[model samples]
Each structure stands twice: as structure tokens, then as C-alpha cells.
Target: MIKNIIFDFGDVFINLDKQATYKELAKLGVTEVSEEMMQVYYRYEMGLITTKEFIDFYHKKFNIAKKDLINAWNAILLNFPLHRLEFLKELEKSSKYRLFLLSNTNELHISWIQNDWGNNLYQEFKNCFEQFYLSHEINLRKPNENIYEFVLGENNLLASETIFIDDTKENTDIAKNMGIHVWNINPETEDVVNLLNRKEFL
Candidate 1:
């Protein structure tokens, strides 16, 4: 029996356009995304670089203003439906399964979410989880063995009793390797609420 559930925020809870940032940058005349930029993004997600530094690096490299670059970087964030929020809230009411949120996100993305959703919505969304873990905030990220270990150890959760749901195959693969059950959801064809409902979780 799954006693704990971990969800990935980006696509599982809130919608995100996986390629929106890159597409937006291309529209802004950043015709090429360099290998260095990819490294920077990785470092940023790992919490190894500051938000200001990340923005500055992109701004200088792309010759774009900081504000515009910020917009491009945040373009991946999309709307969070009220239905999803309500679903999670309902799930939380059960108290049978411990709930956690784990996302590979950075400062700019978080700031954009706050600005877009406002404090109340953001708080309500966050309140649905027992623990909310952001990659940048925690200095660790998914698809990394240590990060998964960190969550399990920190929360005293049993891997066998936990189910991790993520849109990324890599993330789910890593969690499965650690003995955690996983749902590798495909956003294009699946609705998280529906999936859970099918599992009789709702």
C-alpha cells in the first residue's frame, strides 16, 4: 500500500510548457542555445548559482535586457487550473497518505509563479502538501540519487510505501531504482486527477 505520495509540480500539478523558454528565446533572436547556457541552467537548478548571476549570464550572452531575458526564462510557466488545486486539496483532506511536492525549479520560475498566481493561490496550492521541495531551494534536484535519498531520509518515509509521480521519465526512473513506485505521466495524454481517480485514490 502506498502511504506516501510525491508529485512533481511543473506538469503534474501546475502546467508548464517544457520547450516554451527555448522557443521564446529563439523568437527573441537568440538563434542558438549554447552548451554553456545548458550548463548554466543545470547549475542553476542544482542551486549552485544565484538567480541574479543566471539572469546576468544569459542577458550578456544573448545581448538581451535583463527584464526581457527574465520573461523569456519564465515563459515555460503556464496556468494552474482551479480543478487541479481542488483535487489536490481534496486528496490532502484524506490524511491517509503523506503528500509532498518535488520540483526542479529555479528562482525566476518561482518568482514568476508567485506573481502570476498571487500569494493566496500559491499558498493554497502549497498548503495541500505536507512538504514542498524545490530544487533550487533545497540545493538538490531530481534524477539525482542523493536528492531522492534526502527526501526519504528527511521525511522518514519508506521507499516501498512511497509513490512518486513525475512527467519526466528520467526522474521516475531514478525513483524506481530506489524502490519507490512511480507514475511516469505523459501530460499530452493524461490528466493527473483522472489518473489518481482511476487508481481509486480519490
Candidate 2:
């Protein structure tokens, strides 16, 4: 039986335009992101560097303004359908399974969300989860073994009885290899509100 459920934030809860950052950056004269730059982004997501340092790196390297860099960084965020929040709240009410939010996210994007969604709405969404793990806050990220291990160890959750739902195949692949059940949802055709279709969890 599945006693715990883990969910990814972007695409699973809030919508994201995954290509928006690249597009927006291109418009700002950033034609390409080098391999080193990607590594820095990963580190930023892991909270290994401060946000100012992150913006400053791009400001110095690409000659882009800090404000523009911040704007490009946040372009990927979009709406969080209230229906999804309602569904999650319903799940929380059932109390049949422990609910968790595990997201590979950075501080700037989160700040944008807080500003966009308002603190009260953001808090309401967060309150639905028993454990909320943000990559920037925890200094860990998804698609990595240690991150999965951290969650399992911290919560004393059995890999066998936990179901992870994410929109990224890479993330789900790692969790699946760790003996956790997974659903790699397609954001275009799937509604998380239809989680009932994933019958095993019920």
C-alpha cells in the first residue's frame, strides 16, 4: 500500500513555460548558455551561491543588467491553477497518506511566485504538504540520488510505499530506480486533478 505521496512543484502544481527563460534570454542578447553557466545554474538551484552572486555572475559575464537577468530567470514561471490546490487540500483532508512536496527550484523563481500568488495563497498551498522540500532551501535537488535518499531518510519513508509524481522523466527515472513508484505526467494532456486515474494510490 502506498502510505506516502511525493509531488514535483512545477508542471505538477504550478504551470511553467520551460522554454521561456531561453527565449527571454535570447531576446536580451544572451544567444547561448555555456556549459559552465549551466553548472552555475545547478549550483544556484542547490543554494550553493547567493542570488546576488548569481545575478552578478551573469551581469559580469554577459554584460547584462541584474534586473534583466532576474527577469529572464523568472520567465519560466506561470499560473498555479486553484483547482490543483483544491485537489491537494482534499487529499490532505483525507489523511490517508502523508503528502510531500519535493521541488528542484531556486530562490529567485520562488520569490516571483510569492509575489505573484500573494503570501496568503502561497502559505495555503504550502500548508497542504506534510513536508515541503525546496532545492534552494535544502541545498539538494532532484534527478540526484542523494536528494531522494535525503527525503527517505528524513521522513523514515519506505521507498516501496511511496509514490512520486513528477513531470520530468529524468526525476521519475531516478526515483523509480530507487524502488519508489512513479508517475511521469505529461503536462499538456494530463491534469493533476485527475490523479484518481492513478488508481493504485487510492
User: Number of the top candidate by TM-score?
Assistant: 2
Model 2 residue 194 distance off true place after TM-score fit, in angstroms: 1.4
lDDT of 2 at 116: 98
Candidate 2 ranges beyond 4 A from true positions: none
lDDT of each: 0.88, 0.93
Q: Put down candidate 1 lDDT per residue, 11-72, tens digits, no spaces.
A: 88788897988898888898787888789998999889998899888778778888888888
Residue 42, model 2: Cα distance from true site in angstroms = 0.5
TM-score of each: 0.95, 0.98
How close is each model in CA RMSD to the real structure?
1.6, 0.8
Clashing pairs for model 2 are: none
Q: In model 2, what lDDT does residue 7 have?
A: 93
Task: For residues 1-202, write the lDDT of model 2, one tens digit per residue.
Answer: 8999999999999999999999999998988889999999999999999998899899999898888889889999999999999999999999988999999999999999999999999999999999999999999998999999999999999999999999999999999999999999999999888876687755
Give model 1's TM-score versus the native structure.
0.95
